[model samples]
Target chain A: MQIFHRSTNTISRATIFGAVFVVAALFWVAATVQRSPYVTYAGVARPQPAPFSHQHHVAGLGIDCRYCHTSVETSSFAGIPPTKTCMNCHSQIWTNAAMLEPVRESYRSGKSLVWNRVNDLPDFVYFNHSIHINKGVGCNTCHGPVDRMPLMYNYASLQMEWCLDCHRAPEKYLRPREQVFNMRYQEPSSSQPVLVDGQPYTDQLSLGMDLVKKYKLRTATDIMSCSTCHR
Target chain B: MRNCRKISLLGALMLLLAGCRQDMHDQPRFKPLAESDFYADLRSARTPVEGTVARGQLHEDTYFYTGKIGNNPGDFMPFPVTEEVLARGRERFDIFCAPCHSRLGDGNGFVPSRGFPRKPPSYHSERLRKAPLGYFFDVISNGFGIMPDYASQIPARDRWCIIAYVRALQLSQNATMADVPSGEKVPSELPRFEEPGSGATLPVVEPKSANSAPEEPK
Candidate 1:
């Protein structure tokens, strides 16, 4: 006995194939977009125990980055500010504020508030904060304009390609050694030559190249080697 | 049969999604300070063996490390205070000490204005100006009063450099005309000090809106 009509079978098969194709395309797009560095990492602000505003501390008060991130220049990790660091000001200024209750509780109990990590790299990547900072790479180069971020988010895609882009040609991102901490430091205008000790000079690119030599930065080949990061 | 085929197809899609979740996050590793049955102490973290000097941490020079010579704060710097060293000291001081001690060493930093525990003693004050080089080093290495020790944050050499910068700051505040080199040109006019409440001198700051205003005094 014939179980199916011949004409309907072809139409049903085609419809099924079409449906499968549409579902597969939708799935691919969703997976790719979700996992892309731009969507997955950059600008994604994770929740912290307190609504700490970098803008208020850095811009409003003009507190330096080194004030709270005390170890950025010396250690591998740019440490989160300790409870004592918070109480150093909050205990006197916002002593009774409900917003700073967690800070007060942490101070009293001697427990650290578990701040959610925003710029997370895979465990395999070996990133050193001190090396980058010491080599005249501005904090804003990686962290973006943290002084303006009311709620800090991951500014750059902390992906391999993203890191290699800077590692390849660091001169474009390099600033003067003194300007490393100046979050709002702007590049000198190319049209107008800045007067340096009575001599006019208009070569930021050359200056950056000189700095690369002065700082003894590794060549792109050495930096891009597999073991440089993977180990 | 048709219903079974549909369910199987759904199951295949679910399996594909499940395959994506490779357990890289939950790896088989001991977290720091985690309890361990494998070790007698049951601590995953092993204590360093007796007298184990870490690499690059052999701080053998007693004078350099402690800033003391035979139980007394030494008067001289461990390293020569070169121009480069002073520059490094200036950078480190601005980053570390200037928060509490101010850039001018006046102890009226932004933190103090915002009500930190107490204003640190001014480095320019006669008492501090006369303080031996090692005294500042000692204070930085092992904190004075409410201030935390910067030993971990600053290297021993950098601490000495900071001391050098502090001395320079003191001299800057108290320098006489004789202190200036005869060959170098000094500014013809001293900077005019602006009196407080002088409208012309002070930049205009917008008043805080009612919503952002500080709470009324109790």
Candidate 2:
């Protein structure tokens, strides 16, 4: 026992206290990393086979979201437009543009041009686009300023915590059903009042809370339950 | 004995670490449009087998699906046209048809202006005004002239809705002052827009004056 100096005891005691801080620091780092773009790919524009701009098609041409995503109202998956959809316009306009070659080739060869999944979720989480859409969630509410996007990217972290934040308090973001697809839909304000069921509201909270009751949204506890998203 | 026990404990810890695999995050099931290695095409979602129809999708209502009575287009709707139906029709029409036909059905939509050679016919034309609703439905179901069949993009019910709206549009264009009901003002307040036709958004349009016909695109 005498082989080590008395200072070794002080060093060992300091190491034990520092170990607690070290573990906590590791946990904090892990959490920050998990939510960062490095882990969730949020806010990062992914490279697709074609650099399709939503700004050009949606905002510029005033195309509705339903034009390409045909089954958003009816199905769990918001239907990706088949290559035929691209060809619908591309066949006539921009026929020889080098940028449209992937679309043209996919149309000609009949092989699917693998577009990168911008807002992919884990295999465990079950999401339904129709139910959320029918319940008066705006496309921009979750997707963010899609009309302004030159290239597509996921706007949210797509994490369990992020899902629960809305599930716990969806009334905060509920909008009029008609305004669901409007990319430029603004939150209610004094200058910009929103009408829901013919009653104008100048604030978001009152409109949202009323919409919560009007839309017959599930109870917070029910929506926040474990089985709601994960079976 | 103690050295051997410590080694065993470390081995157990290593085994625990080895269990952290991504099997659950990427389970061996296909999502919609997921890629597959087993299929040569690498498409996980398969097309329906040739000539086979899915159950409950028989689409037995010939008039609903085809809009035809006896090899000729029918003149009426398979379902009752309510305000809700017309609204649905207008929304669908704007998304699908308005790109070429224009919201006015005047054949001056953004797509035609963007070098699309064949301009969609104006609904206000005398021949089109006389055309049966089913004729429009058939044209939307099957390709007509340079236009492609929108059967894949638009469901049957929606295609019917578009026709209903198109009929409304035709009537709106050709109405006489006598068609105005008793007390309503002739020209109610026209919507004011902040800016005219920016490429990003549609400008509020004034109602076309009665004297002005649907002009041909030069």
Best by DockQ: 2
Candidate 1 local lDDT, residue A60: 67
Give candidate 1 misplaced runs (Cα > 4 Å): A1-32, A35-41, A87-96, A191-210, B1-4, B25-60, B188-218
Alpha-carbon shift of residue A87 in model 2 (angstroms): 0.7
Best by TM-score: 2
Question: In candidate 1, what are the lDDT values of residues A35-107, reduced to their tens digit?
Answer: 5755656887778889999887776666678767877888778877767778656756778888899999988
CAPRI grade, predicted model 2: acceptable
Tens-digit per-residue lDDT, B82-181, candidate 1: 9879888877787778766777889887666766657888887778888888788888888878777777667888898888988888888898989998
Report, to 2 decimal places, the DockQ of model 1: 0.14
Q: Output the lDDT of residue A194, model 2.
A: 65
If you assessed candidate 1 against the hidden native complex, which CAPRI class would it receive?
incorrect
Scored against the true structure, residue B33 in model 1 reaches a CA lDDT of 38
After superposition on all CA atoms, what RMSD does each candidate show versus the true structure? Answer: 9.3, 5.7
Give the worst 10-residue stretch by lDDT in candidate 2 chain A. A191-200
lDDT of 2 by residue, B26-133 (tens): 899999988999999999999899989999779889999999998999999999999878998888888888888888999989887988877888889999999999
